[model samples]
Target: MRSDRRTQLLRRGRNVECASLVYNIIEVAVSLTAGFATGSSALISWGVDSIVEGNSAAFMVWRLHGEAAGISEREVLKRKKTALGVLSAAFSIAVVFILYEAISKFISGETASLSWWGIGILLVSLVVNPLLAWGKYRYGKLTDSPTLKYDAIDTIICEYQTIVVLVGIAFVQWKGWWWADPVAALLIVPYVAWEAFHAGRDAYQVDLDASVSG
Candidate 1:
């Protein structure tokens, strides 16, 4: 009975990870397409942000699959740490580029054309991301998986990014406050950077723990 319950939980985790992968891939394509069409740098940056989240989701999928395959805990931990470290580096670099683009837009006083596609995409994500994040969080707690917990946090980050992007676009469309777009884009940087720092820090701590144990 105990073994059966464990198997059931593992199956559910795999399903959740698979769903995350599919959703993120679609999100990246939609966000990039709409962003380019509308000439919205904030939207473009948001699309790039999704790529980072997608990579994290991919790692989670890999880890979950490894667990299902009866891989050793040590091996899985090593892979997880490596994946988180790489993602942390990617997040830092991405944040730099996002900030640069936002600043350029601000300085140039550039205005993006209104895009219903961008708005529509964000609306869909606003619904999807929160639900997905909550599911991951609940499962993570049930299983005591730090990786899933942090993965859910990454999804939460995506939700926040979606909100800021929508607000930026809305302000321009509603009141012609052109600065709102870039300003809103800039707001996303701090949260993303903080998340990256924590991920990196956690990965390092795990490595240290493993080293001491070994």
Candidate 2:
């Protein structure tokens, strides 16, 4: 009975991870291209957010599979921490670039080209992200998998972050307040940093078998 429950939870994790991977891949391509062409900070931030989402998905694949395989403590800990380190670095770099571009674009008074594709990506993310997050979160609860849970939280955060970015984009497109996009994009940096920092801390705790949460 106990074994069956764990197996079911891991299966659910895999399903959610697969879904996340597909969505992230599609969003990244569109948002990155659109952001660069339009010089829109909000679009760019969403692009970065997509990358993070993809990373989370990739992490989920490993975690879900590891759980399925009944991963050893030492190996799981090492893999989890390594993933966290790499992901945190990627996020930090993105924040730096987003802040720099947002400021530069605002000061230069350049208007980003608004496209329907950007809006479409935002809409897709709004639905897909929450769905994925909820799926992973529930399974994580059942099995007590921190990695799975964190990935879901990251997904949800991406959803919120994207919405915030879109709001900025809307203001720019509607009111021509170019600065609002950048400011709003900048506002999310602190929260992203906080999430990344906590992820790192959790990763470091792996050696102690904190992955089991007991």
Candidate 3:
């Protein structure tokens, strides 16, 4: 019975990760295309972040599958630390890109132009992210997988950022506040930094645990 339950949990975790992979692929392609077409650096950076998050999801699938294949939990935990390290670096890159763009736009007094396609893409993401996050959260709890829970939180943050971007674009279109776009994009930087710090901290803690265990 215990073995059966473990198998079931692993299966669910795989399904969730696979779904996330597919979603992120679509998100990256669509968002980047839209960002370029609309000249929205915020959107471009968000798409890049999607690629990073997708890498983490891929690692989750690998880790969960390895455990199901009888690999030691400690080994899996070490790989997770590596994955989180990569994710932290990705977040740092994303922050740098976003800040650069935001500053450039602010200094140049250039407003980011939006398009119907971009707005449509953002709307789709607004819907998809919450649902994806909920699914990951539920499965993470069921399987007691902190990695999945962390990914779900990341997805939630992405969803919130989507809303921020959408609102920024909307305000710019409706009120002619060219600065709204950069201001909104800047608002997300603190959250991005917070996540990056936590990712690094989590990786560090995992490393300490592994060292002590060794």
C-alpha RMSD for every candidate: 2.8, 2.1, 2.7
Worst 10-residue lDDT window, candidate 1: 205-214
**Residue 20, candidate 2: C-alpha displacement in angstroms:** 0.5
Across 11-38, the per-residue lDDT of candidate 2 in tens digits comes to 7788889888888989989988888878
Instruction: Arrange candidates by TM-score, descending.
Output: 1, 2, 3
TM-score of model 3 (CA atoms): 0.90
Residue 42 of model 3: what lDDT?
69
Worst 10-residue lDDT window, candidate 3: 205-214
Query: In order, how many clashes per candidate?
Result: 0, 0, 0
Better candidate number, 1 or 3, judged by TM-score: 1
Comparing 1 and 2 by lDDT, which wins?
Answer: 1
| Candidates 2 and 3 compared by lDDT, better number | 3
lDDT of 3: 0.79
Which predicted model would earn the best lDDT? 1
The residue-by-residue lDDT of candidate 1 on 1-214, one tens digit each, is: 2255654665677678788888888888988898778768789888888888888878777877776666666776777778779888878987997898889888899888987777888899999998899888887877777678778888987888898899889898889998988888788899779877987987787752352121
Better of 2 and 3 by TM-score: 2
Q: Report lDDT per candidate.
A: 0.80, 0.78, 0.79
